[model samples]
Target chain A: MNTAMLLLTYAVVLGAVAPAMLQRASWVERAPRLAMAAWRSLTVAVPGAALLAGLTMVVPASPLGAPLARALDACVMMMQDSYATPQRVLIIMVALLLSVAIITRVAYGVGVELGRAWWERRRHMAVLRMVARRDVRLDVLVVHHRAAIAYCLPGRGGSIVLSSSALSALGDRRLAAVLAHERAHLRGRHHLLTATARGLRRAFPLITLFATAEREIDRLAELAADDAAVHASDRLTVADALLTLADDHVLPGPALGTTPHDTGQRVRRLLKRTPPLHPVVTLVIALLAWTAMAAPLVAAAMPAVATIGVDCCPTR
Target chain B: MRGFGELEAAIMDVMWAAEAALPVREVLNRLRPDREPAFTTVQTVMDILYRKGWVDRRLEGRGYRYWATAGRDDYVAGLMSSALKSSPDRAAALARFVERMNPAEVEELRAALEAARTGEPPP
Candidate 1:
């Protein structure tokens, strides 16, 4: 019971508070992949810890030295003192309901979103293959559009799509920067991250952690791609490419009313040449994220840990 | 598979340019002179296109003549429409570039970029 309470508290605190703390950490923009890892771990840790805490309530502890399987089986033989009271029985029932609800909802949300995205991409690809010309030398799809647009579709059929106007506007090096950025998105499978974020955020809207995951993941992904683009082309070229496309796509009026947080920030960050965090700091973040993901499972197994390998008779 | 896709786009282009449905012979003729594709290859690509719903076909005389179901503009529009949809699916940015920024933001971005390009501090 104490272990379960500890886990429940951990989940609640992590879910309710982590987002605000993370946003304050300025390194997030500098180390986007790490920030994304942190968010990914938090989403898993919150639900995982909650589900485990609920499991601890529903399943009674086994005899000393018994394994986890034995403990699970012991639940059916509910002659344990833990289940003796009517209140205890009610608590277990509620906990069981919660665990089941969490598992099913998460599964349904992610499954439906992934499937819908796959189907949508298929329909889009069907049209794209027919309309777009394959530029084997550039290794991208080219569409004859006046707008200077660029994008990539992700999956087996996915390729970077560049507009004819965009092709003419950018010089070879500037185009390389843009291509590298899109390729980075594809390589990182950022679409899957964005899709999963949407699923989780919608699944648990009230949970602040899940609620903010989609937007943060999206912004962080673009930053990460920008970072990757720098490896191929200098920051100045990437910034130039961005401005050229923006210049071509700019409309006259307020139809472009502000949700300009990401683009503006990306340009400023590139211009400012924000220094990346130290390698040691990045290593620390990656380790911390892994540890966060692993901790919930350890907490959930606290009871089993107490029972296993304590064969005192053998010691005697 | 790459060859088939290239051929498919090539064939579709001929159909889009033609005033009416053309037989496989006509499509092969319209293709660039650098590479001459076989008549059978053109027929096979149009067959695949018909199945994929990009083009519709009917038997004229002995051979099938294919015409695009939609124009080039419509397909380009379809691709752009999905990218531009304010849906959550586009959260990953189907277009890795712009995401419909306000004109003010675009201006701000251009100013910042210009400063970077010219090595001048922002005014």
Candidate 2:
């Protein structure tokens, strides 16, 4: 019971407040890869801790070390003995149902999200093979369109796509930067991260953390990829490539997506090239991320360890 | 790197290039593969395309003639229109890089997108 409360408190505080704090942090703009790691860790850890808390309530945490069958038998006996009253039994049942419900929703949401993406990509790849020709010089799929465009279709046999006009518009340095950006996305497997974010948002639409994580991951991932582009060409050149594409498109429009600011930010971030966090700061951040993931698992296990020690080495 | 996937694409190219439906034998002769693809292989691939609804086929003169279901340009146009839409597309198939500035202009861009997709506005 104490273990359950401890975990629940951690989950509540982390889930309710961390996203707001993270979003406002200026340091993330300087250390985007770290930001991505933080978000991914939060996604796994928060819900996980909640689920474990629920499980701790559903079953009595008796000492574990006997054979599997005997251990489960002891657990079941403890659950029945401790929850003798109707109200307590009902509470335990509710916790079990809630845990199962969360598990089901997450599984279904992720399955549908990932499955839908895979199907759409397969269909797109087939049509792309028919329509776009592989460019010999650049080795990218080229569509003969005037709108300056560049993107990557990521997954199995992933390929970068560039519009013919983008080809004509980007000079050597900018083109190299652009290619590196798209390549970084593919190499880092950003799509899986994105798809999982989308899935979690779908599963938990009302949760501010999941919603914020989805947007933040999408935003920070671009920054992370831009950092990769810095290796191929200077940051200013990458900024130029962004502006060139923005200028090339003649369309005046108002879909002002919730995140066109991300593009604006990307360009600004490149122009000012903030130095990465110091190694010690980065290491400290890494340790914090590890703690967020590991703490719940340890908390959940502590009950079992306590029970085991009491049973095996009785104090005089 | 190109394998059966490239062959499928090559065969589609042949169908798209033709003015009218052509028999499997003609497709085989027209194919410029690194190595010659057998008549049976061409027929099998065209059958696959027909099954996939990428091609329309008719049986005439003891062989089937196949033509593309839609013009190559139309397919590319549809793809461009959807791909150009700003982020978090339902499928999220394309990780696009068109970014930044000028908010009031989006209304015009939407209309331009619709017009370009419908009309044969080749860039």
Q: Relative to the true structure, how large is the alpha-carbon lDDT of every model?
A: 0.78, 0.79
**Model 1 pairs whose backbones collide:** none
Clash pairs, candidate 2, are A146-B123, A252-B105, A252-B108, A252-B109, A253-B105, A253-B106, A253-B107, A254-B106, A254-B107
Q: Which residue segments of model 1 deviate by more than 4 Å? A: A62-85, A249-258, A309-316, B24-48, B58-64, B92-95, B120-123
Give the per-residue lDDT of model 1 (tens digit) for A1-316.
7777888899998887888988789999899999998999988888988888888877645222244444554433433667888999999899899889999988888887777778878777877887887899999999888777788888776899998988999979989989999999999998888888878876787877886777788888888888887778888777777777766543233334124567767777888878889999999989988888898777666665554434212234
- Deviation (Å) of A91 in candidate 2: 1.6
* Every candidate's TM-score, chain A alone: 0.91, 0.93
- Native contacts, share recovered per candidate: 0.55, 0.43
lDDT of model 2, residue A248: 47
- Compare the candidates by DockQ and give the number of the best one: 1
lDDT of 1 by residue, B76-110 (tens): 87787666555666543363565656667678777
Interface C-alpha RMSD, model 1: 3.5
Q: Pick the candidate with the highest lDDT.
A: 2
